[model samples]
Target: MRIFLGWTLFPVWSGWAVTGPKEVTAKQGSPLAVSCSYKPGYELYPKYWCRPGFLRFCFTYIAQTNGSEVTVTQGRVSIRDNHTSRSFMVTFSGVTTEDADWYSCGVKRRLWFNPQHSMEVMVSPGKAGARRWWRQWQRQHSRVCLCLCRLPGRGERSHHRAGIPGGVSLGELHVPARR
Candidate 1:
């Protein structure tokens, strides 16, 4: 579930200063929040959030950061802030293997600079049944489109980065069959 909470910064790229949940856990289809606060000097750019995995170059711009607030318009992605905390909430209706990835939230104000306030979202199946269901569904359904299996195997998957980190790369080895 990719949601746009508006623009926190823009074109300006820096690094993450502080972030939240440290380590968050949730069951399939549950709500998730990946939040962070940039250095006082900079803010997050309200860019449209994108899907977890894809085969080609893709990106969506949502809005702009007015001052400290961002407005995002994507599925279930939302931004909430208080004096002490700011974060992005990612909600999924039916969690699948496709929903797993290490999400990064940051801002890029310009091309010359790097993004700031980067955070990682580690999404995993809450239970073995959830994972098994996802695999069964995929094995019986996938038609060879774009895959996000950075470490492809009989069942394991990976995320495809859009035009970043050279897109996506898979490992040489695969995992043993899960029984």
Candidate 2:
């Protein structure tokens, strides 16, 4: 399994932050879940999951937790917010190519919205060849793609910059492949 960490720092906003994977790759027809964490101050605010619209600052809400623990489902998409955890989770069941797009997890504010965290969800064809290519690439460039040298008990202390091929940075966190 492949794991991607989306970590970004927004200089424009203070006291507000969103954390999640910067990008997620899911196979078409499979279920995908993306977890987003927000600042504790916004725990009581309504949490929302939305697709970014073409217009700047416009978002189309797919579903929201509406300040409750109940899971809200809209079609194949579902969103649940856990105030205790200061986070929310969005899940898509039977994802399709049409589902591939940019999504945001945000807190609804009185005057504005704090959709600080956004992620690109890519729905791939799930072809065997593509999987093979990814595995081969990971194996051949294991040092660059992912730094296994830092693993516990590896006895190596090299700090490899964490990033993926598309120039997306995963910050300082080392994401290990799922066995």
Candidate 3:
């Protein structure tokens, strides 16, 4: 005898989803990109934004179907459509670490299955030391010693006597107490 599964017995459809941004970076202010993808034919109809298992923020209109843009939070949050590839480009400028969370992109189609995509947006504050060192390093190799100090802060003063890479010399750290 053959047994059948409930879901398999009925018509089933397949939808596509994305999890991460194609490219991401953490700047002085936190910014995030919510990614989404589809399998075509499932036109990004009536696309809706949500907080995942929570509430729906906005829904796209037919006029905005092919392309649309929405601004939120005093223009801090915005969504741009990439009709060429059927992807939504959502951006959050001046974002903070607390902005990290799961966002949902819901799509409606003829199929009752109703497609949905989600991505976690993580915004991290720029690494202070790393950024400072990187900026100094870009100026000139002679400033590398200063870059090192930025990384280790006051502790690096002692290591300054250890010499820097590229055979560059650094001044010694002299403490009157040690003398």
Candidate 4:
């Protein structure tokens, strides 16, 4: 049987657990990914991601990998399981303010406790929010490296390296993380 007391859902069975980052941040209109990992023995079990609203009433399958390494995509979201890593990843193609929600990742087991964990996704506004986030991150971390490179046999060689208060653009992380 399944039990849903409130926001959290607990199943009556084994006591297996899954772990992952409890919170993730993303900028609107950019891509975001959340990963949940399970123990070794559950590697072959199907993995799924969904919003809690589905667990108690709908019993729906948002995005699931039928115990396979292949990725599953539903609309703008996709779920991929990596057996070797014993983890599953869910990605959102274009994040919006409405996309910010509490999501769950689970390893599905028949007649057994399905290990699951909740993740909170926070989406910031547009470019302004991204710049604000970058500035805040810069304040928290003391070290950010900036590097410039040129071809091996080029004309005059120029090298530049910067530490903490270095200069980085929206393209710093190389991922549209700031876009």
lDDT of 4 at 79: 92
Kindly list the per-residue Cα lDDT of model 3 for residues 97-142, writing each as its tens digit: 5666666665655555455655566555578746877767755653
Backbone clashes in model 1: 37
Model 4, residue 172: distance off in Å is 39
Model 2 per-residue lDDT tens digits across residues 1-179: 12222122322362246688889999978899999888777777777778866632335678777788789999888988888888889999988889998887777777644655777999886676478778787766544444644566555566455545433343444455332
lDDT by residue for model 1 over 1-179, one digit each (tens)?
12332233332223344344444445666676555554553444443223323421124422223335544435545543332344444333455545554444444355534343323344566678678888787666433333355343455555442222221243233323333
TM-score of each: 0.42, 0.61, 0.46, 0.60
lDDT (Cα, 0-100) at 72 in candidate 2 = 93
Error of 3 at 135 (Å): 20
Q: Model 3, residue 144: what's the lDDT?
A: 31
Candidate 4 Cα misplacement greater than 4 A, ranges: 1-16, 54-58, 128-179
Worst 10 residues of 3 by lDDT: 56-65
- Measured on C-alpha atoms, candidate 4 has an lDDT of 0.74
Question: Better model by lDDT, 1 or 3?
Answer: 3
Considering summed lDDT, which 10 consecutive residues are worst modelled in model 2? Answer: 1-10
Pull out the clashing pairs in model 2. Answer: 6-21, 6-22
1 versus 2: better TM-score goes to:
2
The candidate with the higher TM-score, 3 or 4, is: 4
- Give one digit per residue, the lDDT tens place, for model 4 in 1-179: 23355325345222246778889999899999888888888888898887767553215667889898999899998999998988888998989999888877887888534667777889988797778888788877645555565545675545555454443433344311111
